[model samples]
Target: MNQGLIPSRYAKALFEYASEHDCDKLVFERMQALSEAFASEPSLVKAVRNPYVSRRDKIQLLTTASGSTEGDSAMTRFMELLADNNRLDMARDIALAYLKIYRREHNICLVTVTSAAPMAEAEEKRLKQLIQRHLGSATMEYNHLINPDLIGGFQVSIDNEKLDASVANELKQLRLKLLN
Candidate 1:
């Protein structure tokens, strides 16, 4: 299930193209829209993957799905290239890879917090502050996940690092220790 080589290659090419053309932001926006549409509409992906669908039709559908008719030429050409190669299925992964580069270039960090229930507003604010302190000058975006299986407590994830304090995780660790 892991995406390797292809997505990153395409994403790097697209990123370089955008950077060269001074349209990285525009391309990023288009890719964001494309990724969101792929997530929200299952049929869109099917259409892109369907062999019966014409290339022009696929491009048109993808453009429409992006929710913008007047998309940047670079992005439009990128979409065409993906369709021509019959690799439209990799669009989402490419977009995600592009986003990672964009975030790194923009000094933005995505943080995820998972807990048994929704966090209170005060707790959320405090958590943001704490993350901000750790991140220094970089900006932080918080995505909260509610997982009842956590039982209680929360976990915070930043890039490759994760701090797990969830009750379920703790219990599992304790069980392993006792078993040993």
Candidate 2:
């Protein structure tokens, strides 16, 4: 079985179930938070995948990390289901899958831009326009970051697409050509 299949299936089922309950929005927000939590804390991933952690505790920790309100049936029930299946450890992947599904359904384009330094106002505006054009007719959410490691220029990631225009990338390509 493909490793990605499990999370995508679970995420789809959860999206449909929550939609039926008329709380898909809340579930979506919680899933976003869950994904962020996984990214920001390595320990959270460790705990979820830890053999020593109880299923109940794992669920509790996930709920808390996701900022799920007490008695939120949709979020709670989803965690419970994950626990019952011994799939709690896959929560991070599931959350990200859920976000992707939700964003697709809502026509939201997630744009991430990273540059060697902060982009000037005109550059930021140009990037936004480029993203808008790339994901035509979709709502765009843009995030910009600085990564000196790029050496210069910038990178843009939209959904599964990537545009790497950094100087480091150019140098690497040139080096490969010279080697060949």
Highest-TM-score candidate: 2
Per-residue accuracy of model 2 over 31-126 as CA lDDT, tens digit each: 999999999999999999899988889999999999998879888988999999989999999999999999999999888999999889997998
Each model's RMSD to truth, in Å? 2.4, 1.7
Give a tens-digit lDDT track for model 1, residues 118-142: 9999998998899889999998867
User: Whole-model lDDT for model 2 versus the true structure?
Assistant: 0.92
Segments of candidate 2 deviating more than 4 angstroms: none
TM-score of each: 0.87, 0.90
C-alpha lDDT of all candidate models, in order = 0.85, 0.92
